[model samples]
Target: MAHLFKVDRVRLLCSCGVLKPITAIYFCRHCLKLRCGNCVSHEVDTLFCPNCLENMPSTEARLKKNRCANCFDCPSCCHTLSTRATSIQAPSPEDSNKTVARKVYYLACTSCRWTSRDVGLKDQTVATGGWSEQDNEHYKYLQSLLEHYRSVAQQEKLDRERKRFSHRKSAYLSLTDKYSLPSLLGRKSLTPLSPYAPKGDSSQSLDMTASEATAEVEGLPDEIFTEEVVLSSVTDMEQRMASPEWQPEKTSDLYPLHKHILVKRSLRCRHCEHNLSKPEYNPSSIKFKIQLGAFYHVPEVRMIRQVELKSEVETCVQVSLCNPTPHDMTLAFLPFVPEAYTAMQQKVEEPTDGGSLNTSSMVRVVDIPPEKTDLTPSADVALPQGQVILAARDDTAEYDDQDSISSYKDDPLVVAWRRANKVGINLLVTPKANVSRAKVGFVLRYDYTNTVATASESRTVTLNIPVMVDVGTVSE
Candidate 1:
């Protein structure tokens, strides 16, 4: 049981030639292929704070620099800062002789026992916001620089568009040629207009003050090695670097940091351009609108127990196959051929019926090829000859003591045990003479019932998935 949690004894080969667990791979229903993280497209859906769970729009998030306004983090420990209320004595306005107790709120970190008062921050009357933020001295200059760069990029984009349209005639010229009108009439009718052309001269004259290099650099303040230092008052590297704009040297200078906003991302299949996983829009909901994890669509293979092996000797290994889908599955073990698998994957890359989005013209600029994996088996596996039928997943099967009836007959030598939707099988493995560990690879051919099938497509389709198992080390 411990080994099952720690080791990936059984791994499925993804279409990108990388071996991953079934949990990490995704099945694209439209393409009928496996997609790994490296081969999928990620899109940010929403930005929200983890502490307050307040959703923020993309524009607002950008304006706020992707941080929550009300929520704050401790500068010392990088933990969520909680508001602590304390009672303080205040003079009553109605009566000058008496005093009243007023509750004041201050930000405190429970993890590091740091408080806003430690940094000379005044306590606020209200619990929520009102935390003073440090102003950046170079903010105006930075904004000017950003605007200059944006205009430059816009100008370059217009130049490229102009170059692309250089071969084609203008709208005025086209109209004149089509109507056989005089050139004077064409010029008087309308000027040649371009959609990509800049509307004003502001973009053309965009500029910023250039920074000049100085010969002298600012030096650190001198203490003359006379003042004693307290280690507790000094800030560590992590605390000082948390706020890049103002790197505080001492704990007294540390200020409450705005909590960084987190984003919920949706994954799409790179080949088919269909969503593989999409979470709900609400920040509080943990449910996903669409999830196509391989664990739900493909058969999962788990090693029942660790098996002992000897070099160049045959050993038996037991493994369990669980059908995760609601439909019954017919599974068979086939000898894995790396060449055949690669060829089959190439054929699977042909575009299939996808969503309404046209992905044919869409080009990927940042598509990174997955690293090549060694599919050669270190050991030989003698697979079972016949097919094994697995029952549909029943949620209540675990509570029932009586076993369900099976229609299809299973070979006793191949199948060791069967319960619910899981079936245990045994296979013979022979490690190489010089190998220290035994590794066996095979192809699991299963009939998958596609739930998202159209009228023209078949509901049941046969898919062959390459599986590799680590059969443990060979005994000396």
Candidate 2:
């Protein structure tokens, strides 16, 4: 049956119990496990201005409040604001004094046709630095509070260390009692050792003015209702929200807002602390230096069509599998059970005391990813027992299709047809009548050839990947 609605075309089950699209998943080469957005740790790679495309260090970015000093975003349309310069006649200093016209720079939004003059801002001699800056209202108080909390935490840590070994008063009283050595006039330690004193200023006095609340409230001005409101003259809610610190209401109070900086992120697998994706250091480059996405490594499975799907009734669905590697792969669909995964992991981690058994399995695949999770297949999917051979990806074969042909026999039941490295697979899907919607899931176990370098230089390894298929809503 055809899907009744449009959803994620393909949603793969992550090891962390997340059902995400194949594009959003990552394949860790080191661990040989699939990682999702929630499972991996994200770290900012580079901080750059999206408008200017200029990169800065983390310290500089933080000092500038993660914003670009030269770039500004329009308050009204949220577009990049351009610095415009105009030659205006300078005002005469006095009756006898003569003045000359000078070119001054001001911020203007090209999209909304908003000029800095609308906000009563005077033109600046310099294009970037002369703009006025307002200090955060609660910055000082917040810093003081942060310092107080830090000192308190530090003191508590010191107290914990001091009390960790001995909490008794005698241990801290005197060296004579602690060491059980009496002072001798003839010989001994030259002078009695004094208790170590941390020589540093411990406490700092803070003068903070607490905010006071009043019962009396001020009402809105009468002019608000009496005066005619012009939408162009007044700032909108979104415009005010751009600069949340100020949130000025009047157009005259709308100042040039700093453009927020964008960051490049690097993803790492939390379980093994391995890099799953990392971009080049150059901000202008768009390619990744080391990206191990599932799309490039994992066998791509996409739903072609569902023939018949109903409650308790068996159906046939066609799913296409495309091999992305350079070497041929033997694919087999199997039942996705937790116990099966555990058994495989046990075989991978058999205890070895440097015996023959340990030496034999030393060249085998190592990482055993976590398989126990909340995500499970809702529908029953019968897998094919026969091994499906998929040809290796050939770039030149795409042009010369007739010249390149594989000799592997295709199964009429499981494999509908084969084209280059891609294969069309047909599998049996049965939906349980207990639920309202039909969902089918299974596992793809393949004989993968790991080309990664190792001490043993072994290539063949078995891999299991979870597969999920959405069969759409069941019939009444």
Candidate 3:
């Protein structure tokens, strides 16, 4: 039986030759093909903090190393840290005889009950961002190494540009005619010298020393073997690894970590380079600007009940089909042919100039081939003959009491029942001799109404989609 948790029972074949459920795939209007997560391109559209809902620009995010400046996470539990304030009595600076109460803020994790005060971190005078950052002992050495590499890279780039410029013909050839050879030589001497040319004393120097490997190592302290260990005061591997710059072994060294930023991305079809899903620009909004999920554009198939299957025995299995579109649909079942789908993919037309220019104009370094999946069915399915008509979707049909089944004449053996924009049909399945789990597949040919009409094309088109259904295990 089809349940919300059992969506994998019925799967649809994606254009990349992978089998996926209808809810996990997308329908591209320009390419007229089914695309899955593996066959689509993802692009980050926005960067924002999930806690404060504050958006940051790309340059600012890169400068901050993709971390939220105003928010923090608990180092022990990795949860969002909340700011808590407390009041304490202190001697007044102007009047030593009087005592005054002042409020201070500290970070706390409600989940793990971890607070900044556990590690002896000083309370912040203000709530936003006054906490001190951890300093690395090798910071100066790392900066020197980075500067040395940057200078080397710059020198190589200059050499490459100088070589390229030397190969090109000089544009000042005509100027030599107006001036004598001596004057032309004098003009060349006034030009600046190439930076790549060697200069003995005037050359810039980088301050960096090469590192050498050594066999000398520091031994563990004698307290490790002489003193007893307390597990509660030690930090786990996960907590220590959270701060890689300074992996804290003891719970007293742990500090609050900066909250990482999250990104909102949009999906695009790889073949035609069209946007399949796009979210709104607002940071707090959950709605989408353009979403083309298969659930909204394709007919949904659901199994009615589980059935037992024996070898050479025809068992009736009921399945319901629901049309999600506003226009009426005419659908028919056809025999599934693996070879036909392969040939059809080869004949798929290339994208033409109809919309905006595609962004994938750069040459690719590696070209990936489409994946191929095995689709052999283990059971035989006796598809009902003729076509089935599903009415357009109506919002008020659920309130109506009158039966909508009497309007259409249907075969009682094939059509089990009829409802608004949905109909149930019976299928006959025969399992193979040694098959434990029965599986059947078929091609669904339906007339689709294209809402994106062009000047030279019609609004209706025919589409064929292959579907595979996993029936229950065969009965002995």
- On lDDT, the candidate that comes out on top is 1
Per-model TM-score, in order, reads 0.82, 0.74, 0.79
Write candidate 3's Cα lDDT for 335-415 as tens digits: 987776665444433323212332221111121344555578888999999998877788899999997545777888888
Q: What is the overall TM-score of model 3 with all chains considered together?
A: 0.79
Q: What is the lDDT of residue 73 in candidate 2?
A: 86
Ten-residue region with minimum lDDT total, candidate 2? 172-181
lDDT of 1: 0.80
What value does the lDDT take at residue 416 in candidate 2? 79
Off by over 4 Å in 3: 1-4, 138-228, 309-313, 340-372
Summarize candidate 2's per-residue lDDT along 1-476 as a digit string, tens digits.
Answer: 24522335556667655567788899876677778776675667888999889999866876687899889887778888888888888766564367778789998999988877887788888877678876779777767776665555444433433453244332211111111112231112321221132522265324445669999899999999999998777888888898888888987788888899998888767556667888997888999988888888888887776455677787787888889888889998877675543443333232222122211101222234545433445568778778999888888877873745558787688887788898998877777867666666678887667767776755677788877667666664
Candidate 1's TM-score reads 0.82
Off by over 4 Å in 2: 1-7, 89-102, 135-236, 306-308, 338-376, 401-406, 434-436
Clashing pairs in 1: none
Each model's lDDT comes to 0.80, 0.69, 0.77
Top-TM-score candidate index: 1
lDDT for residue 83 in candidate 1, whole number 0-100: 99
Per-candidate total of colliding backbone pairs: 0, 2, 0
